[model samples]
Target: MNNTVPEDGEQLRAAVRERYSRSVGPLLANQPNSANSCCSSDCCTPPSTQDVRDTTSTDCCSTDCCSTSQADPITGDLYNAAELGTLPIAAVLASRGCGNPTALAELKEGEKVLDLGSGGGIDVLLSARRVGPGGFAYGLDMTDDMLAIAERNRQEAGIQNVQFLKGIIEDIPLPNDSIDVIISNCVINLAADKGQVLREAQRVLVPGGRFAVSDIIFQGQIPPALRSDLESWAGCIAGALEENVYRQLLQQAGFTDIEVEVTRRYTLEEIAAGGARASIAVLNEEERRQTEGKFVSAFIRARKPAKQV
Candidate 1:
């Protein structure tokens, strides 16, 4: 079946908002998940050539998409036990990222940090701790419910250095060249206008500031008929860009020293069983050839040029 949601942002954005809010509704209502983790779908690899389920939740949307799901292939156990222990249960449960950018970003004390889709504020809190009280961590999210949960998580953590902002990543509320670093987890792929997002990112980062983030990227061909349908595979994994395209976009946005490191790869299977919409969904043999071996969860790093003097 064909999906038109890609041509627009509001529909996909709304789906993300509603889906993420529901992921934490149980905990927000004082009822924790027995499993202690709610997960988003994995990346869009569609499984191996043998048609076997990869068991990776890496394809489409998730509750957070990047939470601590040990059983999930895409949204694997990203946070270590030590990292998990430090966060409030709500923060841990509300996580929805594909990678741990805060852990990977090499943040220094007193650095100003920003989390793009900072759902539930997992990375923000972690960065706050990493940067210490001398540093400030900011989380930017469009969802009110997610922001509310994040604020509560911040309070519970007692991180006075953190602030949660209500805004979309495409248009950050902060000033240009005001941030020292920017980070995101599996959230960039959700944006409909990726170029605009990158432009905004470049605008906010300070000279020599680092742009370290984790995201989903695709390579190879996706037939028009199935692209959005597969994207409907769910949450943040939707609207992924090709690896090379992502690099080009970064360069065009005036970022330098760009690097994309693959942390996990995702595969998809036919919609025969346990599929979101088995009957209507279509990713047959011809398409699977191009689709398989293409999706990956990556940590993309870049930097704004140092001041020219």
Candidate 2:
């Protein structure tokens, strides 16, 4: 795999840790409390469009796709319990995902699962319940604050079958071929070395074990100017890889049946305005138009092909 860890990788990692640590706990808590309220995108307005024609769904394209979107803090159907739901909301508030991992993972009862960058324990809690008493779920993340939040959530939810570990997705802290499924959400792009991340994911999964994730993927090349802007990169736009690159990376990592399904596409305006805060909105008119409708969020699925020949 290419060693593309930018010289700024360490700095970027620090920035990410600091940023998410401060805001994530509160953000997850607010998700269910403010169901219809504008998510992170409510903070900024996207650029006005003057194109001849428009062609994207408002649901598929957030007005400000560049910003972080709050997750459904409650584990799927689990927090519905009147007693559990009434507990201090931390358990329900640990999710930071774009798509529902439980739904895509197709997890079976008693199957082992691993969640990469499992923030706030949202997906882990849900997965644990899905696997029932026989299955187990493990969450791995590098941020101490995130792990703390997740641990709190796990305790609050009384989910004994799940385990939280401190680790990077690019260098997982688990035994190889031990997990039956892997899931992640909107976290992979934040890595400076996605190639290493995928390889690590492949290394940890059992044969035929599933890999399902939701993340941002560029439809084509992002201009050089946009690529280097750290704010844009951290906001999940500039650092995105092209769709083909996603496929190639997974294939190269020994994953099979790679699928890069575009769940939603974001126009340039959408991404720039995503978190409702964009440092890139300063671009000129032509530059703005050049990038319209160029990015997407996808539900990617692949498998560690059942013990290759």
Candidate 3:
């Protein structure tokens, strides 16, 4: 139903670029319309920027990337507590994530935090407060539009300890072992080379530093047609590495204590509502049914071994 992999990747990237560019203007004003939130959908058309906060759908996840506390897998303790009230409006508005890294990261006060694929700086802004004036946060994104929006957010928030860098995750612009913690939200699966992402996460982090991310991980092998589907890739389903493979890749990259925890699985209806079928025809009945409600979004936590002398 979908085109080959390369085609999907390009389309997804384009959608991301366009959506962020459009949302940038709204983000700077700090009166963001929730409907404008951009995710893999500009590629997959998942939840609109605004639809992410629907209590009936997203449930416990706040649009604010700052809420990092743990919650029940089924009963939804995380959703009920809503422990992330400390974030700035910019953060809540710019958030385009599936999980909250701030809670999962277990960040200490004054430790440096780096957000890969920082987007409009939702996680970065949230992390800035956690680290306080003694600590710093760095948001790295490849999109110039996103970087500009982040900078505006930084200025508006009056946060001096945060900086935005324009770059990709596979080849980060930061120095070696320069960060104390790394956090990302639904961004890593988008990279063309996830291994390089793991490697870079290791390279930039100090020994014992943690990699906390909220991403989509597959339960099993995705269909070849879906795997090669660029729109699906952008939508965050196609490119997802299986759970076991993700753990293995982390270990191979010298990360330890790896944890891949599944939190939610999207229904076929949800996927279709979010626009996951945009690139291909929703023609095949089997394809439509197979894709319905099958993707899982989870929090991924791992650590780089303390430097070995």
Which candidate comes out best when scored by lDDT?
1
Per candidate, the number of residue pairs that clash is 19, 12, 16
**TM-score for each of the candidates:** 0.83, 0.77, 0.76
> Per-residue lDDT for 58 in model 2?
31
For candidate 1, write residues 160-224 as lDDT tens digits. 99999998888999998999999998788778788999999999999999999998777765445
The local distance difference test score of each candidate is: 0.72, 0.66, 0.67
User: 194-236, model 3: which lDDT tens digit per residue?
Assistant: 8989999999999889888888777765656667655566556
Q: How many clashing residue pairs, candidate 2?
A: 12
Order candidates by TM-score, high to low: 1, 2, 3
User: Which candidate comes out best when scored by TM-score?
Assistant: 1
Please report, as a residue range, the 10-residue window in candidate 2 with the lowest summed lDDT: 44-53
True-structure RMSD for candidate 1: 7.5
> Which runs in model 2 stand beyond 4 Å of their true positions?
1-6, 25-88, 91-94, 276-279
Candidate that beats the other on lDDT, 1 or 3, i.e. the better one: 1
Candidate 3 backbone overlaps, count: 16
State, as a TM-score between 0 and 1, how close model 3 is to the true structure.
0.76
The model with the greater lDDT, 1 or 2, is 1
